[model samples]
Target: MIDKRLRVVLAEDSVVLRDGMVELLGARGCEVVAATGTAPELLAAVAAHRPDVAVVDIRMPPTHTDEGIRAAVDIRARTPEVGILVFSQHVETVWASRLLADGTAGVGYLLKERVARTSEFVDALRRVADGGTALDPAVVTQLLRGGQRHKVDALTPREYEVLELMAQGHSNRSIATLFAVSERAVEKHVAAVFAKFGLRATDTDNRRVKAVLTYLAESGS
Candidate 1:
């Protein structure tokens, strides 16, 4: 099902793990374009090669905190075509959603433990590279804490789907296609969602982005 060879950029702080991933993916039929262990390297390597996907560790470089997540965000903004598969020790739902919180071109958040399942891990890379979405089991588990009501109260099931896609910065046309509706219908739903969230302002984009960010912040997802 993979149409073309996938190019991967990997960033993990552990030398051994980074090397192992590079080898594992390469053996699995992906091209390992570059690899690094620092946040700066992640940014620079991604900028330089613009690979098809980036597999980044959640912690890296200075502080080894959210550097990989932050790098993934910046990389997403710069290289929209590149998919980012974030590897984390813990289920960082907020950051994971934030990474996917804009344009669904190619985004994934997987925990490190899953790497042993080579088939599944490579499948995730392919899905992301092919414009699909994948989230770690743990990530989804964490998101469940937000509960259905967090969005269900303010949006129709369909509109809530649109809203979550919108949270990923998907456009009206994209959301429309996802829901098998017209752009106009998507617009209407968006309007209603804005109204429900009190985000129907001239600063719609900013407010909407902030609203989702607030939701994620509050729910820790």
Candidate 2:
């Protein structure tokens, strides 16, 4: 459950879908600060509201091809604090990579049909709002398959497992629980994964994000 009420800006070209999402999010205790249909309107709404998160569709007005994702990228450039959740029917790996080019924090990409449950959607949104990732497993799989074979191959099986869970936005404690291991064990695995990826502690960079970035970059997705 979301610890705090979230203020959101929603962008979807389909009026029915947009309205439905507004109502659904409201029912789930989120305040829809603004709901828009076009990319321009979506950008304006986000700039005006500075919402906790923005739920965006990949297609929008005019061309309806990739305006939404473009707007999302722009939002990332101009308002890094606003979390973005790309909810689309299609999985555009190129668009996903572009959205996550700079960082993974406060980002999520989930296929609409795969969401299955409202609770899951809300949980993903909450995670993104809290500066965490919420990538779909399919997306993670594609990224993993595309990454540099040599780099990926260097990890031990356990380290690879930890990396996958990390990409899915699982905290060390959560990963530990899932593996039925101690948190310290999870941390060791995480550290091993980081070391294998050549990620080191830095004042200006988040090693975890960098590790995920390396995974995505090598994937060329």
Candidate 3:
């Protein structure tokens, strides 16, 4: 169940790949409202169409180093409601951190390889468009193993488990189910995590995103 048609704007430098993506999205019932190769075009298309989601490539046109990422960040700032899914060949933890720094909801960073599996890729897009997250597990592993744990060293082992799952974009309920613990207990641990990180719990703020950002910040990822 896809309730409504998901509109998308795609940014990819490769013509072949871009065409393929358009076809794929169309087959999956997503309307490719606009597709562009350069970051500027992508941004403009997003502004014009205001699509439900934007599928961005990490490298596109000109320098191809971080143009897509820069565009993704811009889109996030300009249209918080529009989802962004970074599809990149390289797994740059720093870039992923920048994307999720503000929050993880309505955001996703998946390796380009994941697009090979049509169903999985489409599902990831849907998840992001629905104000959820879909971070690559490898991205999480890279951040954890990158050796930036001075602040995180203070967390208890159980807290570390909770944080890791959170970084993987799991909800509190999902984490509780995985640990087979009461949701209330999970809430306590999550609260403790926020306290340890010195993040204020407010109804207007997303504590989960802040907590994960703290994890990335500590790891310098």
Tens-digit per-residue lDDT, 110-178, candidate 1: 777665778888998888877666665456556545433354366688777777786565788988888
Residue 129, candidate 1: alpha-carbon lDDT: 75
lDDT of 2 by residue, 34-72 (tens): 999999999999989999999999988898789899899
Worst 10 residues of 1 by lDDT: 212-221
Q: Is candidate 1 or candidate 2 better by lDDT?
A: 2
Over 4 Å off in model 2, which ranges?
144-210, 213-221
Off by over 4 Å in 1: 1-3, 114-116, 141-145, 149-170, 174-182, 190-221
Backbone clashes in each candidate structure, one number apiece?
A: 2, 0, 0
Clashing pairs in 1: 101-168, 102-168
Clashing pairs in 2: none
For all candidates in order, the CA lDDT equals 0.74, 0.82, 0.83
Residues 1-221, candidate 3: write the lDDT tens digits.
Answer: 66789999999999999999999899899999998999999999999999999999988789979899889989998899899999888876666667776768788888877556888899999989988777776676674454334556778999989987887667789899999999899888888888877778676676677678557556533
